[model samples]
Target: MPPAQTTAAPPSPAARALPAARRSLAPDLARGVMLLVIAAAHAHLFALMATGTDATLFGTWDRIATGTMTLFADLRGYPMFAALFGYGMAQIHRRRSEQGREWPWTRKLLRRRGLWMIAFGAVHVALLFFGDILAVYGLLALVFVGALRLSDRALLGSAAAALLAASAFVFTITFAAGGVPQLPEKPQGLLGELALRLSMWPFMIILMTAATLFPFLIGIWAARRRLLERPEQHLPLLRRTAPAGIAVAVLGAIPQALIKTGVWTDVSAAVGAGAATLHQITGFAGGLGYAALIGLVAVRIAGRPGPIATALAALGQRSLTFYLLQSVAWAVLFASYGLDLRVSTAAGVAIGAAVWLVTVVLAELMRRADMRGPAERALRRLTYGTTAAHGRAD
Candidate 1:
C-alpha cells in the first residue's frame, strides 16, 4: 500500500491577510459604521435640544430612542478607533525596525500627528461642537508613545488598571461632589459654555487621556495577539465576550436611563449617578466586545463583499475627511448662528441619523469617482508629504 499522505490545511483568507489586513478594508468598514453611530448620538442630542421640549408623549418616544442610541453611543467608535490607531502605530514600529531605522522618528511623527489633531480639534470645538474628540485622541496618542515598548501582557494589564482607576475616580469625585456637575442653573451663554469647557480642560484631558489610551493599548495588544490575523482563533473569545459586553452595557445604561426618564427619585438619583461610572466602564468593555464581534463577522464575510461593508470601507478609508465633514455639517445645522437647533436628547438622535445617511451616501459617491474626501486627501499629503496615490479612497 502506498504511504498515506498528510497535508496542512490551507490558511483561511482572514488568517492569510493577518497583519497586512489591519490596513485593509475590514477595520475601516467597522470604523465607518461606528462613526455613523457616533454621529447619530451627536445629531440626535442637538436636534432634541433645538426642539426645546420636555418628556411629553413625543419626548417619551424620544427618550426610548435616545436610550437605544446610548447603547450604541457608549459602545461604539472611539474604542475601535483607539484600537486601530494602536495597531497602526505598532505596524509602523515594526516596519521601521525591519528597515533598520531608528524608532524615535516614529515617535516624532506621532507627535506631529497629535499636534495636527489638536489644531484640528481646536478649530472643530471652537467652530463646531465642543465635544470634539480629535484633540483628545491626539493628546492621548502622544502619551501612548511611551507605552509602545511594553509587552502585550503589560499593555493589557495597564489598560485594564487605568480603566478601573479612572472609572473609580470619576465615580468617587462625582459622588463626593454630590452629583454630576451641571453647566450652572442658567444656560451659560455660548461664550460662557466655551469658557466652562476651557476651565474643564484639565479634567477633560485627564478623562479623555485615560479613555483613549487604554483602548489604544488594547488595540496594540490585539495586534500582538494576531487576533485580527486569525479571526477563527478569536471566535470563541468573541462568543463569550459579546454576551457579556451586551449585559454590562445594559446594566451600565440602566441607571442613566432611569435618571433620564425621571423614574429615579433623588435618593436613587444619587445612587444612580454614582453608578453611572459603571456605565462608562461597561461601555468601554462593551465597545471592546463589539469590536471583537465585528472582527469575527469580517472574517466570515471575507472574500464575500457586501454593499454595507463596501460602503463602510469607503467611509472608513476617508474617515478623516468624513470626521471633519461631520463637524462642518453639524455646525451649520446646529450652531447658534445656523439652524440653532440645540435639541438635547431624543430629537438629536433623529437628526443625527439623517445627517449620517447623507454623509454615507456622499462618501460612497466620492469613492466611485476615485476621489478621496477632501480632508482625507489633505491629511494624506501631510502625513506622507506627497501627492495622493491612486487607489480606492478608503
Candidate 2:
C-alpha cells in the first residue's frame, strides 16, 4: 500500500508576522526606538552644556536623568543598530540571490551609502558635535561589505574574536598610559576641532571599524537562524537572554560609573582601569543579551497590532529622513551658529520627548499619505538608480 501523503503544517503566528517578501517590521521599530533614545541622550548633553546656571529647576534632576541615560546607552541601542545594519546587508544579499541577481552591485550601493553618510557626518561634526557616529558607521560599513561572504558561524566567531582583541588592546594601552586618550583640554574652537578630527580620522576609522564588526556579525547570525523572521521560535531563548544581558551590561558599566561618580579615586582609577579590562567581556555579553531581549520583544509584538508600534515602524521605514532631520534640528538648537537653546537638563528631557512625539506624529501622517521622507526617497533612488514611483508623498 502507498504510504499516506505527508502534509506540511501551516505557518506559525511568528512566521506570519512578517510578509514573505518584505523585511521584519520589528527590526525597523527597534531601530526607531534606538533613535529616540539617541536623541534623548544628545538632548541631555546639549542641555547640560548649555545651561547658564550651574543649577536650575532641572539641575536637581540631572543625576537621575544622566544615570538613566548612561545606563540605556551602555545597555542597548548602539549595539542593536550595529547588529541590524549587518542583518540588513545579509537581507540584501539573500534577496538578490533569490532573484538570481549578482550581489556585487549591492556592494557598490553600500559603498555609496557609506560615502554619503561620511559626508553627512563630517558636516554634522563640524557644525554640530564631534561625537557623531555617522562617520564611524559609514567607515565600518565599507569594511563589513568585504565580510559579507563569510559563513554565518565564521562571521560570528571572527567578529567576537576581533571585539575581544580590540577591547583588550584599548584597555591595555589606556591603562598603561594611565587613562584613555581624550581630546585636548580646552575646546580648540570649532575649526580646531575639525582639523584635529581630520588628523585623527585614520585612528578613529580603525577603532570604529573593529567596534562595528561584532554587531554586524550578530546581525548576520540572526538572519541565518531566521531569528527575526520567526520570533516565536526564539521566545524561550530571549527570555533567558534578557536578564543575562542586563546583568552583563550592569557589570560592564560599574567600573565606568564608579569612576564618573567619584566613588573610584585616582588610586582606584588605576585599579579600576585594570578591572575595566573585564568590561570588554561584559560589553559583548550584555550587548548580545540586549539584542536578544529586544528581538524577543519584537517577536511578541509581531502578532498583536498596536498603534504605537505601527507608528514606530513607520518612522523606521523612513529612518534616514528622520535621522538626518534630527541632526539638522539639533544643530539648529544646540550649535552656536544656530538658535543655541542649550537650555538645561529638565528642558533637554522635555525637548527630547517633544521631538520624539513630533516625529511619531509626522511619521504616521506621512505613512497615511503613502509618502516616504525626502531623504529616504533620494537614497533609495541613488542606490537603486530607478525612481520607479516609490515614496509617493500623498
Candidate 3:
C-alpha cells in the first residue's frame, strides 16, 4: 500500500518520470499494434459520411474486410488502451511512492495531469476529432483515483460490477432506441462542424466512460499482478488467456459481423440489440486477449527485438501524436469542406492502412533521432510544469 500521509513530501530536485530504458516492451508493442486496429476501426467511418461501420453498401472485398475487422478490431482496440491507461496510472503511483511521495502528493499530481488531459481532449474534439477518448480517461482519473487503494478482491469485484452495468446499459439503450441514429446533414462550414462535434462530445464522454471503466479497472488489477511487465513469469496464464479470450471475442462478434455483412439481414430489433450487447461484452475479452498475445510476443523477443518490433515500440511511445494525426487524415479525407471522398469500405481500409504505415515510418525516424512526439512533449510540459525535463527524463 502507498504511504497514507496527508501532507505533501518535500519535492526532490531529481524526481522524474520513468526513463525509456526502464520501460517494458510489451505495453509499447501492444499500443503500437493497437493503433492499426484503431485505424481499421475508424477508417470506414470516414468513407462516406459513415459515423463508424454503418456503411450501407459492401462489395465482396468489403464483406471480407468488414467480417475480419468486426471479428478482431471493432470495439477491441480502445479497451486494451484503456487497460494500458490504468496500468500506467499504477506505474505512476509506484514510481512516486518510490520517490518518497505519499498518496496526497501523488493524488494531486494525478489530478493535475487529468485536468490537462481534459483540456487536451477538448481541443482535440473542437479542432480535429469527435471521438476523443482523452477526456473520458481524464475524467476517470478525477473520479476513480481512490480505486488505486482498493484491495485485490475489491478491485476485481468492482470490475465485474462495471462490466455488468455497461452491458445492461448498452442493451437497454439499444433496445429503447431500436436502431442507430441517423447522421445529421453536413454542417455549412468549419465553424458549424466544430459546433456539431462539441455538442456531441459530452454524450460521447458519458457513453465511452461507461463502456471503458471495466477494462480500466481490470487493467489496474492486471498491473498489480505485473502481468504485462513480467510475462515470462506468467507464461501459463498468458497462454491460456490469449486463445480463450480471443475465441470468445471472435465467436461473440459473429452475429454482429453477419448482420453487418448482409448474411443475417431482416433481423428483429431484439436480435440486433442482443448482438450489439454481446459484441460489446465480448470485446473486453478480445482486448485482453490481444494484450496477452502481445505479452507472449514480448517474451519471445525479450533479448533481440527485430526492426518491426523496434519500429512498433517507437510508434507506441508516440501513440498520442499518431492518433491525432489520424484524426487529421480523416478530416482532410472525409470532411465536406475537404476532399469528402466517398470511397468504398475496402478502399477506406486500404487508405487507413497506408496512413498507419506512414506513421510507423515517421515514428521510426523520430525514434532514431531520439525525439519525443510533439503531443507527448507538450503534455509532459503541462503536467510537470517547471520540472518538465526532469519529470519526463527523456
State the displacement of the C-alpha of residue 312, model 3, in Å, after optimal TM-score superposition: 0.2
Stretches > 4 Å off in candidate 1: 1-23, 48-58, 180-202, 268-270, 342-344, 387-394
lDDT value for candidate 1? 0.66
State how far residue 284 of model 3 sits from its true place (Å).
0.2
lDDT of 1 by residue, 1-394 (tens): 2122311332222222223134555567777877877788667656655555543335566768766765657445566777777776676565544444455765776677677777777777665565667888788667667777887678778988988777777677667766543322212357754664465566666666766777788877776665765667777887787677767777777776665555554644357557667667777777777777777787878877688777777787778788778877876777565656655566677777777888788878976786766765554445545533332222
Q: What is the TM-score of each candidate against the true structure?
A: 0.84, 0.80, 0.94
Q: Flag the better candidate by TM-score, 1 or 3.
A: 3
Task: Please rank every candidate by TM-score, starting with the best.
Answer: 3, 1, 2
Superior by lDDT: candidate 2 or candidate 3: 3
Q: What is the lDDT of residue 386 in candidate 3?
A: 62
Among all candidates shown, the one with the greatest lDDT? 3
lDDT rank, highest first?
A: 3, 1, 2
Q: Over 4 Å off in model 2, which ranges?
A: 1-23, 48-60, 176-204, 267-269, 272-281, 343-350, 388-394
Q: Which candidate is the best by TM-score?
A: 3
lDDT of 3 by residue, 103-196 (tens): 8877987898889899989999999888899999999999998889999999999999999999988888777767333445556578988998
- Scanning candidate 2 in windows of ten residues, the lowest lDDT window is 6-15
Backbone clashes, each candidate? 14, 0, 0
For model 3, the superposed segments whose C-alpha errors exceed 4 Å read 1-14, 48-56, 179-188, 390-394
